[model samples]
Structures are given as structure tokens and as C-alpha cells.
Target chain A: MALKFKTPMLDELEKGPWPSFVTDVKRMAARKPACEDWLGLMEMSYEHKEGHWKHGGIVGVFGYGGGVIGRYCDRPDLFPNVAHFHTMRVNQPASKFYNTDVLRKLCDMWDRRGSGLTNMHGSTGDIILLGTTTDQLEPVFYELTHDFGMDLGGSGSNLRTPEGCVGMARCEWSCIDTQALIYDLTMEYQDALHRPMFPYKFKFKASGCACDCVAAIARADCSIIGTWRDNIRIDQEAVRAYANGELVPQAGAHGSEKYKLDIKAEVVDLCPTRCMEWDGKNLKIWDEDCTRCMHCIRVMPRALRPGLDTGATILVGAKAPILEGAQLSSVVIPFMKMEPPYEEFKGFVEKMWDLWMEEGKNRERLGELIQRMGLREFLKACELTPDPRMVNTPRFNPYIFYDPAEVPGGWERDLKDFRSRHQA
Target chain B: MSEEAKARIIEWVKQQKKTKHYFNDLCKAVPEIKMMQAKKIINELVNEGRLKYWSSGSTTMYMLPGQDDVAKEEKGMN
Candidate 1:
């Protein structure tokens, strides 16, 4: 326990400006002897310029295909304590809210059963409990489910944990209750979350508005963002106040003094759709032209509000760079009312899942599949109507190919007939 | 109904013999049952020790308990 091995290179990591994982491991090492050996193993890995850990064998709760990540130390002879290190992904609550008492109990349980290391939230929004043994996985899972009333998040080729922004809880601009929608979907798809049921990992993320604090549009396979159908509500008095510099712009989101609030220069000109115009006395917004990018509303929160007709915009096929390059979600269902039970939304998701499972190749992400099969095919398979909002622009270069069924006559007769007319 | 689905799923895998089946493949085994229902039956089979999960780091597949090479190699560890 008392500095089991020298870690000069690892010690150098603790001297940097940013907080280091080495320091975190050392802190955990104080309470758990296994963590000390983990540090030794890591230091050896750093010295050798290669990792010493390997993932293999069956290590998970009974009946679940995911949640526990199996890991083994390649050089187990030297670092026996960390011989069978594994990771467990605990499903986080919607928007990651927790009372101090619950957090303390979780920490206590983790300390007793594993190396007390955690990623507050992993990329998929699960509370990743790092470094535990295979033998402890079942007991830890039992304690987690029975005592804490918590379940493990998804991993492997399954539906990963769904994430949402803090909507209706604190933000006024939120068009939908992101937290509630996320909770509903999570409960409804618990099987897909725990079991490997997809060709590859599928992610669902909800943002309260187009501000997209959770980055759902860039990351999730299915992105749900709040939107409005009607015109932006304008408060004339509040607009005048902001124009006179009596009130701060962006509700002081940006430092007030650094950038002067010019209603004409900053707010009106910065509008993406160029729908707003401001004279010295009054501001007029061409609502018909507004794209609802949320910029004008953000800059003048007190002056403008989202419309009464609020709903969510659902997009499909977004992912980080993998087999295909990164893609922002394309508008699938431009707008849909997101409410409790979420029957329609859940059905839509299942329909997409059915198509992906049946047609998608192994290790192919949804976005990649969409690219391969084409968006027209995806829509046809899902029985979705084509919407104008689904595309940024129509195809410019017109080298269009027609299907045999679409042409005047079938392709079978066309080739022979064309040859008869043109040549022998 | 679940029993029938479970039997069909197991029979399909057993017929394949050495083939590691994806979750969709098991769902395909029982065409009469819904995908979610098939998923439930498969999980039940695993819990009842009739089947087991196999993984290739990123991808997860199912097979009969003794049919997995990785599990067989690390038999002593398990």
C-alpha cells in the first residue's frame, strides 16, 4: 500500500495544469490496494508504450449481453490485484440529477466492491464504474439493482443509453419536456438497452431546443430537438429596453461590458435567415422567412419567446466519424408532438429499428446504412412521407437514374429496342 | 406461447450447430413472435443456462453454451 512501485513518468502527469487520472488513481490507491497495483500496471504500460489490458471471456450479469466490460491483465503475474479488471456501466438518471444521499451511497457501494474509479459520465451518458474483478460483478450488480433501484446501461451492439437536456426543469426556451421524454423511452426500451439487439450501437438523444446543449444532432442515431411552428413572440417594451442599452442582451450570457448590445448590429444582423429588421424606434421580424435557429430568441430572451404551437423535430442517421464521415442528423419527421406514453414516437423508433435490423450489414451504423441504401429507400421502407424540410436543397446535377418500373416500358425490352434503332 | 418461441429459437441455433447467431437471427427463428417477445425469450434462455452470450469486443452474438471458442479457452477463469 505504501508506494508499491516507483512511477516517475506517472508522477510527471500530476504536475500539469489539468487534473490528471494518475492523481485520481493514487487517491483511490490509498483506500484500495488493488488500485495501487493498477497504477503500477499503468506506469509499466506508459514505459512500454503499449497497454497491458486485454478484454476476453464472459463477464456480465446473468441474462444481460452488456453493461459489464470484461478486461484482463496480460501480465497478471506482476500485478495480481488487477488481474481481472472489469468495467460496469450504470444507467444514469434523466439529465443526471441525484441527491447527495444517493450519490454518497453509490460511492460507498462502489468503494466496497471495486477500485473506486469512475467516469462521472461516459460518452454514452452512463456512469462508468471502472476497475472491478469478474467475481465481484454479480454481487455488485445485485447490490446496485436491489439496494439502489438502478440498472446497468447498454454496451456492445445494442441501444446505448438515451440522454436529454434539462428541459422544463430550469430553461424557459425548452419547447418539450426533454427529461420526461427520455425517461419514457428508457423505460419502454429496457430490453434493447440491456441486450444486444442491433447490428451495431444505436443512440437516442433529446435536446430541449435547437441550441442542442447535449450535441444530439451530431452524435445520436435518432436526434429529437424541440421546435415551434408559429411566429416568435416579441415584447415591444423589452425590445426597446434592449435597444436603449437599459437591459443587457443575451440575458448576460456573454459578458455585458465586452461586447456592446447593438440591437441592429448584433441581434438583427446576426439572424441566420435575415428575417429581422430594426429601426431606431421599432423592430420588425418577417416571421414567414424565419427558420427558427434560436439565435434571435437567445440574444433577446426577455424580448422574444417561442410560439404557442410547440413540438419536437425528429431527425435520423447522425453519428460521429467511423466507417463513414461525421454527419449531422437530417430532418426525418419535421415536427411531431412529443408527449407521455409516447406511443407514436415509440412506434416510429421500432419501425426504424426493424428496417435497420433486417437490412443493415454487420458493424454498419444507421447513418452508413442510410448512405448505402439512400434516403429515398429509407423513407420507402419506413413508410414515411417525403417532407420539404428533409433536404437543404434539391439535387442540382441531373444525372438521374430511373428504375425499370418507373420508365415508359420495362428495362428488358429497352436494351434490345435501343440496339435495333442505333446499330446492328 | 413464449415456450414455443423459446423452443423454436433453441432449435434454430442447434440446427446451425457451430454458427454464432446474431440477435436478429434468433428473432428470425420464431417468425410468428414479435421481435421484443423473441428478445425476452432469448434472455430467459440465457438466464436458464440453455444459451450464452459471445462477444467480439464490439459485437455481441449468442450460441449454445459450449460452442464458444473464447469461453472454452478461458474455461478455467470462468
Candidate 2:
């Protein structure tokens, strides 16, 4: 029998052009027609009535034992691919060397046994399988682990999938290996990800450098940004080429005479720590205290480059909506050595999670908890000695008010006479 | 044409008067009424001088004139 379904109301469609959920349900309906009851519920969501389905439900996936989400589907059959299919967060390989053939084989198995549709990455940083029955769950998991060498990520209240930027493989700007950090954390904190015993969600992200292309600034609860303590490398030949009009500045008023002069005087002259010094013939950089602000590099792109001996800097408390508002991740552990199977990085992640889980309130994200309790408490709980670089002191002025009645001598009598005269 | 619609509109008007609401707020309170219908009714009341309208930004508010002040002026003239 073909299951019957109705469209959602006009008011519900006010947000976008196409209804997002309807499309998903339609896909499910194609597979399991009986699941159309889910569609009916969604259509009548605003009717304010009771039915067999309420707000939430528990869904399980094959292979994965823990981290199940209690979900609610207004239209079940419409989401047939996801009907019984739950997300499985597999720890990414230490080295992200994906053999195209291996990936294709996994996808082929998934399409045959499960729903053709898949979310490459789930909310918790898991590889989400859209739909699979309870019967297929165990076999699929065994195949994934024993055959494919895959592991699951976080599901419930645990630390979610750790993510990172494409390191030295493609980009020249990357100073440290983000791929290694992501893999190491995944292996070390497998228990934290699979377990469901935290106040709220915990997220982590790693960037190749401070450029933060992964949006580590706003997305993750904990962020690791790659940085260098060394100075910038400047090439005088490139600076002169730009200055003499042989090369044009990347943007802004580069071609103009005023901009050229400003670049020479303001930018080249004001290089802090004498990073950019002009010796009549050529410009040279000190390569010691550059701070990597990329100020010089951005101005004279052809001339300046980033230095070596760079490592990762750990930042905490970046999440959107859950705590207060969107916040940039603050620097926590200033710098740590980055290597594969990173024990230092793994230890940091564990300490952060333990502190947050112990103190965080219901629905409060790690960032919100850090903001409320202050970073001092977090550092103390984690037993990390306060580094001078980590100390963030907020400035405030104390106000002391003086009482007029406390003024000595005849000041009281003068005020009394003045009050009597002013009386209406 | 529905009794519910009429009751809703009446309730909206009463709430508007109690809260000293803008005409736009009164219109918003009764979403069942079309924008043109709400505008027409407000214009009719304004034209008949039954209600006074105040313009704020792009929106308009409506209210009855002071009945006590009008009565006092008439009494003074007499």
C-alpha cells in the first residue's frame, strides 16, 4: 500500500524556499512506504494535539554500542535512511592517507546494506550512516573495525569528534602538523567520545596555523591553533621589487603613490623588534621577535615569509548559542610540542573535559562554564601551574563614595540653613 | 465573516486600548485580518474622526480623543 502524506502549512515555509525536512522524508518514503506515518505527524506539528508520537525517540545503529541519541522525527518513513540508522563517530586515522579505493568500498557497502544517503560528517564529528536496520548493526560494526580498521566517535554527553585543518600536505602557511594532533587525541580519548556522562557537549578542533580556516574560533569548545615563537623571514629583494613598482601589492591602495609611500614609511619603518631593517641597498628582517602578525608579510607578500620551529597553541571555550553568544576561543595552553601519538595534547584534552564535566551546569557548554567560573578555577582544578602568558587580568576601578553628613565642623549647619531657604 | 474572527478582532481592539498600543500593534494582534482590511478600517475611523492616529517611524498608532477634556470645554462655553 502507498502511504499517504500531506504538505506542511504556509507559515512553516516562511523561513526558506524549499522545506528541508520534507525532502529527507520523501527520500525515506521511496524506501519504506509504511514510514509515511512520520510525514503525517510533521504536517500536523502545529495543530497542538496528542498522538502516538510525541517529541523524542531513541535510535540505535549497528556496530556502535554507546552514544545513541534520543531523536524525534515528525515524519519517520520520509527519513527511512535515518529511520534505524544512527551516527557512528569513527576516530580519523593518525595520518589522513585515504586510499580512494578503500573509501569507495566503504561507500559501496553502506549503499547496499544501508541508505544510499549519508552525512560525511555528523554533528558529533562521526561518520553518519543514514539508514540501517537493527539486524545489520552488529555485522556492519564488526566489518568496519575488523576489516576496515575504523573506530566510532562521541555520541551522547561525551567529547565529540576532534577535527583539524589540512596540514603541510597542500598549504605552505601551515607551521605544525594538525592531522597528527587530531589522530592522537582521537586514539587517546576514545573512551571519552563513546561515553555519555557529561553535563553537555564537548567539541575540539585543530588548525594548521592561526589562520583558523576550520572556524575553530567559533565552532569548537576547545581549539588548538598552530603558531611560532620565532620571527618572520623577510627578503629585501622582494620588498624593493614591490617598492620600485616591479611588483604590485596584493590589495588596498598598492598601485597608488600615496599607498607605496605609506607601505615604505609606516609598514617597513614600524617593524617591531627591527624585524624589517633597510640598509641603503636592501631590507632585512631580524627573524627573532616577529610575533607572526603577518603585518609585514601582508604588506610586502613577495618579500616576507613565516619562520620554522613552530608548534601548536591550545585555546579553550569556543561554542555558539549554548552558553551566552558566539565567542572566539581563548588561548589556554600557550604552546605545546606537536608530534604523532601526542601524549601532552591528549593529557590536556582529558584534564579540560574532567574539569568541565565536574563543574559545568545543565545545558552550559565548556566555554560558558569557563566564562562563569573564571579560567583561574579551571587551571587550578586541572593542576596546571598558571603561566605568566596565560594570566588574563580584567581591569576594573573601585569607587568610594563620601557621605556629606560626615564633613567636619559647621558644614552641617550651613547645609541645614540652605535646605530651609530652599524649602518651597 | 467567522464569529471567532470577529471576537478576535474585538479582543485585539480592547487590548490595544488598554495597552495604549500603536495601530500596527493592533493589526499584529489580529493576524487573521488582512493588511488591506486592517488599513481600511483604521482609515475609516480616522476619516470619521472617531479615532486619532499618531505616526511613529513607518508605523501608526490609534487612540480615542480625551472625552473628559471635550466635556469640560463644552461646560465652560455654556
lDDT top scorer: 1
After superposition, candidate 1 runs with Cα above 4 Å error: A394-424, B1-21, B24-41, B66-78
For chain B alone, what TM-score does every candidate structure achieve against the true structure?
0.86, 0.49
Tens digits of per-residue lDDT for model 2 on A1-424?
3446555552355458765655665566676543355455545654655442322122234322244332234334444323343333455553345788868867887766665556655544456665455456566667777888886556544567788878777767777777767876777766556533455667788787766767786788888788777766667777777676666675444453423424547576666545666655576666554545556766666776666778877878887774498887877787787877677877876677667655666557888988899877787776666564554432233333334553465243476778888984
On a 0 to 100 scale, what is the lDDT of residue A402 in model 2? 35
TM-score of 2: 0.61
**Least accurate stretch of 10 residues (summed lDDT) in model 1 chain A?**
A393-402
Kindly report which residue stretches of model 2 are placed more than 4 angstroms away from their true locations once superposed: A1-58, A61-97, A123-125, A243-291, A295-302, A384-424, B1-78
List TM-scores for all candidates, in order.
0.89, 0.61
Q: Indicate the TM-score of model 1.
A: 0.89
Candidate that would win on DockQ: 1
| Displacement of the residue A39 alpha carbon in candidate 2, Å | 7.9
Q: Model 2: DockQ against the native?
A: 0.01
**Each model's interface RMSD (Å)?**
2.1, 27.2
